[model samples]
Target: MLTFEIMLEVDENKSLEGNVELVPQLTLDCVIFGFHGSSLKVLLLKWKGTEYYSLPGGTVKQEESLDDAAIRVLKERTGLDKIFLRQFYTFGKVERYDRESIRKKLAHLVNPDLWYKRPISVGYYALVDFEEVFPNPDLLSESCGWWDLSDVPELLFDHNEILEKALHALRLELSFQPVGLNLLPEKFTMPDMMRMYEAILGKKIDPRNFQKKILKSGIVIKLDEVKKGVAHKSPFLYKFDANKYEEVLKEGGLFFI
Candidate 1:
């Protein structure tokens, strides 16, 4: 029942002096996923002048609702207001708190004392179009971009564990949800869709069986047109039947792979 409550766009340079109206000891960490061809990518922020990298995160403001804060932060980072965002977990292990690590990683940006207090972070994962996302770094980060999940380096804090938990949550929901619509283009072949599933699940799906199962779900509709200019047989393109997709999502158990 944990909801999204992150604040990635807050200007809180003086919060340590008790000036900013931020919710004490609460933060939001986002694990954004984007698909690029065959790879599942995660968005990360690189701290300036350091080898440290972390998920984009911020402290929640006292005035905004948790859901509102998450929506605003996601829109600020991805430049898309209607993308898929889900709060998967809340991480607050006592061992995960490391004040010195925070001070060391952000020495150049702000006074380390600013984040000395340990926070209970809410984790949210989002699915966005790889091409549509306009990655923007905040004041403390040097660059923001996608990293292939397999190649993700050692992250700051307990972020690696958070990322792993987020992925596990995503895979759990994949069979029952039309999450593909968020990661794929408007028009795509069944093969393209299957590949996306395979990428996330880390396995290849049987083509014939996948097609049959998906078609039976009634979430996608085959179009009259096929992919053009292919050397091999051009497969018919398909699109999500928005109404049917939403209906299936609402019903929940009806749709499965």
Candidate 2:
């Protein structure tokens, strides 16, 4: 997205000649969700001279794949590379551009008349570890940081709608796959995995059923080690048995908890 951040970060003089070279009409918006062991958060970009916020987005280049464009944008905004991003939906509401708030914010980077022609935006979402990400805000943006999914501010355009749909799809995805396996560290306790699931699904999972389902999936293997330093009984540590996980995937590729 060519927000003030792009104008400021890439062009301090407010000129759009170079930025215009980017492909037109097609845009990519990415929703990067993170877990910090307690609260779940989404990465956001706050514009300069305005209180409004937006998901980190960019124009898809003529030569790059849509998937590569999302990866490029994510890396630019977060300094991350090679992270998995899944396309969840495409937004093409004619009335999506009817709002005046985002237009005013983009006035610094795009011509008022030209900016009003809203581009069809593709949506992609990825899960990440909050601690591993380093927030890197581009020029024209005041800050780049995590916003709690529950405490997100009034976002610009149809972004609020996009976030709602992404979260819905993810919750449904969790019912059949171990999507968060990559979000956690290599070794973790059952409680750690349980908490991550609860955060994504937005509900509490019973401890007994939670452990049973995960272990029964045969995707993860229980390690001999256990969590230490906690006051209660120690929880065992575990890791995904890559060989078995892949074998199960080849054998129909389904895991439910």
TM-score winner? 1
TM-score of each: 0.87, 0.85
For model 2, how does the per-residue alpha-carbon lDDT over 57-120 read when each residue is reduced to its tens digit? 8777667788888888888877778675789999988777763654567666444455546678
Off by over 4 Å in 2: 1-20, 103-111, 175-178, 247-257
Expressed as tens digits, the lDDT of each residue in 92-170 for candidate 1 is 9887867676666655555546555567889999999899999987656778999999999999989999999999898
Model 1 pairs whose backbones collide: none
Candidate number with greatest lDDT: 1
Q: Output the worst ten-in-a-row residue range by lDDT, candidate 2.
A: 8-17
Q: Local distance difference test, per candidate?
A: 0.81, 0.74
